[model samples]
Target: MLSKVVRTIARPFDERFNLTNRLHESLLDKPVPDHARRYYFCFGGIAFFLFLTQAITGVLLTMYYVPSQDQAYSSVFYISNYVNYGWLLRSIHNWGAQLMVVFVMLHMLRVYITASYKHPREFNWVVGMLLLMTTMAFTLTGYLLPWDQKAYWGSTVTISLVEKVPFFGKSMANIIMGGDKLGQATLTRFFSAHIMVLPAGLVLFMAAHFWMVRKQGISGPL
Candidate 1:
């Protein structure tokens, strides 16, 4: 009965737009080689799964999070202590982010070891690198949102390192932190980047990466 209802609802769209064929081609018809079916080959999918997990939990965190230097710590405390299940959500988001970085590294290493980055797949390699960098940026920015002592000292050290980078380094660091110091401005900047800019960039790069993979298919064994 449930399946009948679904088909009935989908029938007009399927007939008018050829939805069934397109769905089959996109999802069901792709072929995978035997070697690429190995356990190690699953890293990229695991990384993507972690990314989805982080996104869902991150959105939930943002609902109760106050992104101010003054209230940030208090808000996080409230979430953990006052809001039901908020602690679990925040924990999952934090750990999922860390694991995403690990899996992305493993996926890139697998690609390099398999010689999958050569020739026509070079552009995809660049995209993967960008994705890695973006993930790092997400971690860095999110680190400061809690506005604790560790976050404070860590961001200060990072900004100091940024200032040491050759020409325009000091200026670039200022632009990112919004001043010479880590205060309310720095919190706002990091929070904005964490929730807004970095997510958009990640989505854009991920779409390109997936499209390329579908077009090129997975490369064969070494």
Candidate 2:
């Protein structure tokens, strides 16, 4: 079964190689069209650029952050007051996250209004929806890392909403908060989810999204 699956994957690679060779032979002398003036193309690119900025700044902030209930807030304060350019890094990360979410939403809106989600691009649209959810998850998990009163109460409200789910609501909230109540375990879990798990998932989905865009080619204006 594994061999069959490997062959299935390798077949496309073989076909791609042959197609590339043929393209090199046939289109080497052709000149591509200049579409630099188009703003739609630029919008997606700008969105991706902002996401990259968020990833970089988020990593830097992680180096100094301590997620414990006792130290989390103080550590963030230390980063802000003591570490050189820490304020700038934290500010960029916070603002960049907001900007990334906005740009991603706008990019999806553009694709939707133009009917780019039709036919072959449907899966890419689905991947994009997952990306949007992941972005919001990242924001929510990170909201509690500072361990401030606002962070604590904000998370309390959010978790209460989660606990309102019908059948498995209480259990699910317990699993998420790491116990029956929010405490050190909850902070640790949120820290890991925010910094590690969600980022990894987002990267995977983003890669798939880009691969599909390349495969189907960009949708043209209607």
Compute each candidate's TM-score over C-alphas: 0.94, 0.82
* Alpha-carbon local distance difference test for all models: 0.93, 0.86
* lDDT accuracy of residue 80 in candidate 2: 93
Cα error of candidate 2 at position 13, Å: 24
Which stretches of model 1 miss by more than 4 angstroms?
1-12
**lDDT for each residue of candidate 2 in 1-222, tens digit (9 for 90 to 100):** 998897788779768687656767664644333543467656677877887888898888888999888899999999999999999999998898888788888888888887889998889989989999998998899889989999999999999999999999999999999998889999999999988899899889989998887676677657
Clashes of 2: 0
Candidate 2 vs. true structure, TM-score:
0.82
* Model 1 RMSD in angstroms: 1.8
Task: Summarize candidate 1's per-residue lDDT along 1-222 as a digit string, tens digits.
Answer: 999999999999999999989999888887788889898899999999999999899989999999987799999999999999988998999899999999999999999999999989999999999999999999999998889999999988988998999999999999988988888999998998998999999999999999999989899878
lDDT of 1 at 211: 96
